[model samples]
Target: MISGRICIGLCFIALAMQVSSAMAEVFTYPALRSSQASDPEQSLLTSTQPMAVIYGSADIGAFVPVIEAFQQDNPFIGVEYHQLQTLEMYDITQSQRANGEPAADLIISSSMDLQMKLANDGYATSYQSSETDALPHWARWRNEAFAVTQEPAVIAYNREFFRENELEPPRTREDFIRLLVNHDELLSEKVTTYDIERSGVGFLFLARDERFFPGIWDFVRILGQAKVKLYSNTSPMLEKIASGQVVLGYNLLGSYAETFTQRNPNLGVILPDDFIVVYSRIAIIPRGARNPDLGGRFLDFMLSIKGQSVLQNEGNFNPVRADVPPSTFSSLIFDRYGERVRSFPVGPGLLVYLDQAKRQRFLRRWQDALLNRR
Candidate 1:
């Protein structure tokens, strides 16, 4: 009788062990803890050979240090970066997704409208980061994408040129046009700006101007009449300004302006009184990403205070986090230059504006206005 009871007990123990093993096979420890299996940080570290690919711009020199720092904390994951022009990045991402291949893990770019379009098209996955609560509403998408860097579009000028010409920086839109038209001798040979036809961000800036500024076409006409030199990208324009080859650049980004000014005190930035448009570079993880868990963790890291500090120190950009202390930006001299920094609201359906038809129309109109089509 004792032997039979012991045999039955052993059989029951064996069945329990088998069930536990099956459960372990189906659910990870972190997944079991959460209602949904989305928290993948611990799993990602333990998983075999994690990898990610990023599509972004090489012009953002500030991202280099920050990415290097992230890599230090995540040694198990290998990240590959593909540097491409803004439009090229967009096209490649869309094409890859359409081909049914694994989409890129992350997309970061200065073209806010394009990023918004991706989010709207259900191409990106929605993720709420722990640090998102501290950000302004305008910086946070339906948790689909997050604005990681905030840069105000302002006027960049060469101090040496201003002093030589005995000219004060322009304060309003009217003053800006007057300066360009009346002081041609000082600016005619040295002015540099965006080539709207060739640049996604430049065209986006023009679209914003069209929406906000009345008679923006006339403004472009004035710039054309000034005989301004047009460049294909912002970095080249900034380089020319830094070298004093260009006396001034309108609608230059604040982050680039600060970086150049740090290296050359002769470079100056002015925020216009009529209203400054602040642009934020955003990041999103594609819905079909092979490593969504790692991508989500990265998004959280970017929105965190530590991440924003890294951006400010390395990239010279303002933090999207509202709680960032005033002392953090005290080193910045926007107020001293009579510049006002303001954030613009993201309009409804703004992302769909990136359709091919709209883009072509905008480029054509911009060319007509800036290149003297008449």
Candidate 2:
């Protein structure tokens, strides 16, 4: 009887081990427990209950108000948000699905190219509603990827420094280039911008800039001449500007800059007069989503006028919907700057630079110009 009992216990252990392995494969704890997961301020997954999982590049702080508002209307649906880098979000979504495992129900990212690639590759599930239908022609593509926020790439500078130094901030690309050329001594290492190779959104901005401005490479070489500092994220550059460490940040996210400017009155933002490049954060429902219906519902909610208000007022994010007036900062900027707002269109054109060989070539050219290697 003792031997029989011991055998039964051994069998139970084996079964438990198998179940643990299966759970690990299913949940992918490493992805969930990313750096953002540990920060209570960054994650909304406090409850142990089942919830719709969202993988996005936006910070959790900005999402809190939107999520809370969503929950008010959707009491039955809980939300689990994981903030990951733009590239990581794309890679994980692709990898998890390729491995035949469930990934996040929703994927939100600022990398338009990557998001477009996913949809083109059939990774996104079709979703549509009245809200989606109302989106502008340039904002939604094929009922797969939806642009949620309209954010521009703007220039941020230290207002105090500009005032004290009696220097006028650059309002156009020509003015910006001239500033760097003329004030090399004062601006040396004082200007910071994104390191495109490391930042997906940065790459997108650079790509758009190149397409919009023919002499963009010459400007890049000028940045190299000025000994510009580089960073992978916008907040750090904004922080540096706010603290007087850096005088200016180029091609910074307008949404984040607006938020930072509110807190730091000394910071200034400029929507370039020559032209402004606008980007929209695209959201997609992954093909392997555990709950596509819930994802669709959330997606619709995000596109709704109600959700857009929460984003503009509470989240400090620009709304994508045009009907949700009074217009957000994007519209205000466009109005003030004239009709130079070059908003990226949600279509196949975004996928051009995403090709492996083409991407490498573009990066190589970027490195050469930034390094002053001709």
lDDT of 1 by residue, 343-367 (tens): 5444345565577888788778777
Q: Highest lDDT: which candidate?
A: 2
Clashes of 1: 0
Q: What's the count of clashing pairs in each model shown?
A: 0, 0
Please give the distance, in angstroms, between residue 341's alpha carbon in candidate 1 and its true position after superposition.
5.1
Model 2, 55-98: lDDT tens per residue?
A: 77886656667777776787656676666677767777766776
Candidate number of the best TM-score: 2
lDDT for 296 in candidate 2 is 87
> Which pairs in model 2 have colliding backbones?
none
- Model 2 bad stretches (over 4 Å): 1-48
